[model samples]
Target: MDEDSSERRWEDMELDILVRIFKTFNIIELTSGISRVCSTWRLACSEPMLWKTLDLGLLKSNYIKIPAAPYVWVSDSSDKRLMRLLKVALGLSRGTITCLIFHYDLYLKDEHLIYTAERCPRLKQLVLPAWNQITKGGICKAIRIWQDLESMTMPSIVHPPYIMEEIGKSCKNFTELKLMGPCDVLFASTLATWLPKLKVLSLRCTVLTKEALILILDSMMHLEVLNISHCVLREVPEPPAPKRVLLELDETIIGKASRLREFYTCLEDSCLMSQRTKADEGLIRWYKYEEWLWRMDEVSSLSVAMEQHVEVGGGGSIVPS
Candidate 1:
C-alpha cells in the first residue's frame, strides 16, 4: 500500500532469478508467460529441460491444464496434445526423466503407449497398471530403451518370458518386479535366470501346485522377500501347532533359498477347516513315505508318499559330505 513497498517490488525484478523461479510452475503458468515475456524470460520459460516429464495423470486430475491448449495439437505436427507434451518434455529434459508413472486407471491407446515408449528413451523406471492396450512386446521395447532401469510394476501381464528376456538383455540394473496375475512356472524361470541380483519378487501365483511352485523358486537363488498371500493354491488345511506364517510349499523351497530372508504364504478362509485337516493327515503320511524313501538307495517317483515325507522333513536331497 505504501510508495516504498511498490518501489522495492519493481527493484527486485531480476531476469536470471525469474528463469529459476519459472521451473516450479505447472503447465499453465509456464505457457502463459513463456512466450509473452521478453526474450530472456521466454528462453527460460521454454527450456526443454523443464518439460522432461509429461505426466498425463495431471490431465486426469485437477492440476494440469484443462483440455490442453489447442496449439499443443498442431494439425500438421505428428505429435498431438499429449504427444506434444511428450515430445516437448523429451526435448526439454533431453533425457532427464528417469522415471515415468502412468496413473493406474489410465486407459491408453496402443498408439499412445507406443509413442511414449519411443519418446522416453532414457526413462529408468515405469509403473503402469491396468493399461489394457499395452502388450508384452510394447513394454519390452520401452523398458529396453532404459539401460539403468531398476524397478517395474504392472497388472494383468499375460506372458512374462519375452518381457523378462528384454529386461535381462537391456536393464542389468533391474532387481525388483511385481506382477498381479497368474505367476506361472515358465515366466518365473525366465525372470530368475535373467535377474541375478534380484532380491524381491511378488507373483500372484496363489493357487499354483507344489510342483510348479518349486520350479518357480528353483531359479531365484537370491530372493529375499516373497508374498504369496494372494496365491490361490496356498490354502493350508490347519495352522501349525506353533503357528508361524509359512506357505504350503515352504518345506520344499526353503532349503534352496540360498539368500532368502522372508516368505509369506498367508491364505484366505476358503479352505480353512479342510486345509487344517488335510495338513494334519498330510503330515502323518509324509513321515511314513520318508522312512520308506530312505530305505531305498534313491526314490524314483515323487508319489504322495514321498511328497508327504518331503513335506514333513523325513528325507531331502541335501546329501551330507
Candidate 2:
C-alpha cells in the first residue's frame, strides 16, 4: 500500500469513526458488503460486542422482495446470497450471538436454521414469525442446540405439544413465549402442563378463549408478565347484540394473579378501528402488524394503537372521517 494514500484514508475516516459508522448498518451490509471492502473493515466487523444481536429483518426492505405469504420459493441466486450472508455473519459472531431476529417474509429452510443454530450456540432470544418451511426436525434440532434460549416470539403452530415438549426438555431457562395466532384451550393446556413455571407470556392480537386464558392465569402459578392486548377473546352477548369482547379480568382474577407485574389486555374499540383501517389502507406491510403492536405497547398498561404515520385532528383515535 502507498504511504500517501493510506495516510489520506486514515485522515478521512479513522478506525474508531469507521466502527461507529459500521454499527449503524444492518447485518446484511455488515456481513455481505462493508466487511468485503478491506481487511481493516473485516477486522472491525468481527468485534464480538457488535455481533450480540443479529437482526436480519432489514434485508427484506433492502434486497429480497419475498411474496406476501408465510413461505415463498426463493430464487436460486437469492438463496445463495442469503446463505453466504448468514455464513459470513455467523462466522463473525463467533458463537456469542444472544439474539437472532428474522423478518416475517424471509422464508427459511431447514439448512439455513441448522447453520444458524450451529453458529449461534449462545442464542437466548429468537423472533421468527414465519416457519412454514421449517420442519419439526429442523426446529427440534435448533432447540436442542439452544439450551440457553429464554424468550421466543414465533408464529403459532397447529400442533403445539411437540414444540412445547421439546422446549421444556431442552431449554431449561425457557420462560418467555409469545404466540402469533389463536390461543385455544389446547394451546393453553399444553403450555400449562409442560411449562408451568413460565414467567412472561405474550399472546398479543390472537384469538383467545376466555376460558383458556383464565385457565392459564389460574394454572401457571409462577406467571409474572402476561400480554393479551389486541387479542380477540371470545364472543359474548352484550345486551343489544353479540359483541366480541376481550377477556375481562375482574378484580378477583387480577387479585389472584397479583404476582403478575404486567397484564396486557385490549378492549379499546378505537385501537381496533385504527388497526383495521391501517390494514385496509395497505400501510401495514410484511405480515407483521401484530408484532409491531406488541413491541409498541409492551411496557404501557393502557396503550392505544395510535397510527403515527398520519396526524390526528380532534378525536383521540387515528381513524379519519
Candidate 3:
C-alpha cells in the first residue's frame, strides 16, 4: 500500500508543470527519448495541447545537400526519419494540430503531406516554404480535407487560381496568406475575386505588380493588414519598359491601406537592410538566414516607408502614412 501511495502522489503533480517541462524538449527527444521513459512521461508527451504547434524547423539539420542546386534536398534516410517523427508527432496530437511549420530545406513528398492532412484535420495555420515536388492535385486534395484552415504561407507557383478557388470554397475562415514569390496581375486578380474576405496578406520580398497592388487595395474590403516590404514593383513606364522598375507606393495606395489596423510598405533607400536589389532576387536562401527571417520584429512587422507617403519608425511602430 505504501508503494501504491507513492506512485499516486507522484502522479498527482500538476499537469501544467509536466507540460511545461515537456515543451523544452526537441522533436527527437520528445518522441524517442522522454516518451519512452515511463507511462506518466508518455502520457504527458501525448497531451494534445503539447502537440498543437508541431514545428519541424529543426528537421533542417538532417537535410542532405545536393550538388548544383540552390535548395538542399532531403536524403532517403532523412525522409524515412522525418516520416517516423511526423507519425509519432501526429499520433500524439490526436488530430488536434492547429499550427505546423516546416523548414525551408525539408522536401516533403505527397505521401508525407497526405498522411499529415489525414491526421491534422483541425490544422489552421500551415507554413511550407518549399513545394518543389508537391503536385497541384496533391496539395488540392490536402486543402480540401483541411476544412478549418485559416492561414498559410506558401511558395510562389505560376498558377495559383485553382488552389485559391479550392480554399475559397472549403475554408470559410481562411483569411491570412503570405506568398513567397511573385504576386503578378493574374495572381492578385485571382485572390481578389476568390478571397474577398482575406484579412491579412504579406507579399514581402517578392515581385509585386502595380496592377495587382491596386486591385488588392481596391477590392479586398475586409483587409486589416498588408505587407509589401522589399517587393520589386512592376514598372509603370509610358510605353511600359521590358524590365520592371522598383516602385515607391504613392499616397493613394497608402491612404487606402492605412485605413487598416496595420499597413507595411517598404523602407527608405538609405536603409541597407530594407533595400533589396534585383541581383539579390532568390540569392538569399531562407534556410541560410532562417533565424533572421523568422525574427518576430522582422516577420511580423507592419511598419512602412515610401517616397513620402509612409515611414516605419525605429521601434517598428506605424507612423501615419
Q: Count the backbone clashes (under 3 Å) in each candidate.
A: 15, 0, 0
lDDT of each: 0.50, 0.71, 0.72
Regions of candidate 3 where Cα sits further than 4 Å from its true position: 1-16, 66-71, 236-240, 276-279, 282-284, 290-321
- 199-223 per-residue lDDT for model 1 (tens digits): 6666532234454457656756676
- CA RMSD of each candidate after superposition: 19.1, 8.7, 9.6
Candidate 2 at residue 256, lDDT?
65
TM-score of every model?
0.56, 0.78, 0.83
- The model with the greatest TM-score is 3
Off by over 4 Å in 2: 1-8, 11-17, 61-73, 235-255, 272-321
TM-score for predicted model 1 compared with the true structure: 0.56
For residue 5, model 1's alpha carbon misses the true position, in angstroms, by 7.5
Put down candidate 2 lDDT per residue, 1-321, tens digits, no spaces. Answer: 866664457324667777887777766567656887888888788888788888765442322343454334555655565677788889888898998877656678889999999999899988886787799999999999999998887777899999999999999999888776778789999999889889888877667777778789889989888987666667444478864654365676567667687876665657863355234331223345543343343634223232222221122221111
What TM-score, to 2 decimals, does candidate 3 have?
A: 0.83
Better TM-score candidate (2, 3) = 3
Which tens-of-lDDT digit does each residue in 1-321 have in candidate 3?
Answer: 675554546455676788898887766667766777777878888888788777775443454464555645656765676678778788777898898877655678888899999999999988887778788888999999999999888878888899999999999999888887788778988999899999999887767777788888888889888887766777555565575665477777777777788777674566443554244662334544434353222335221111111111122211111
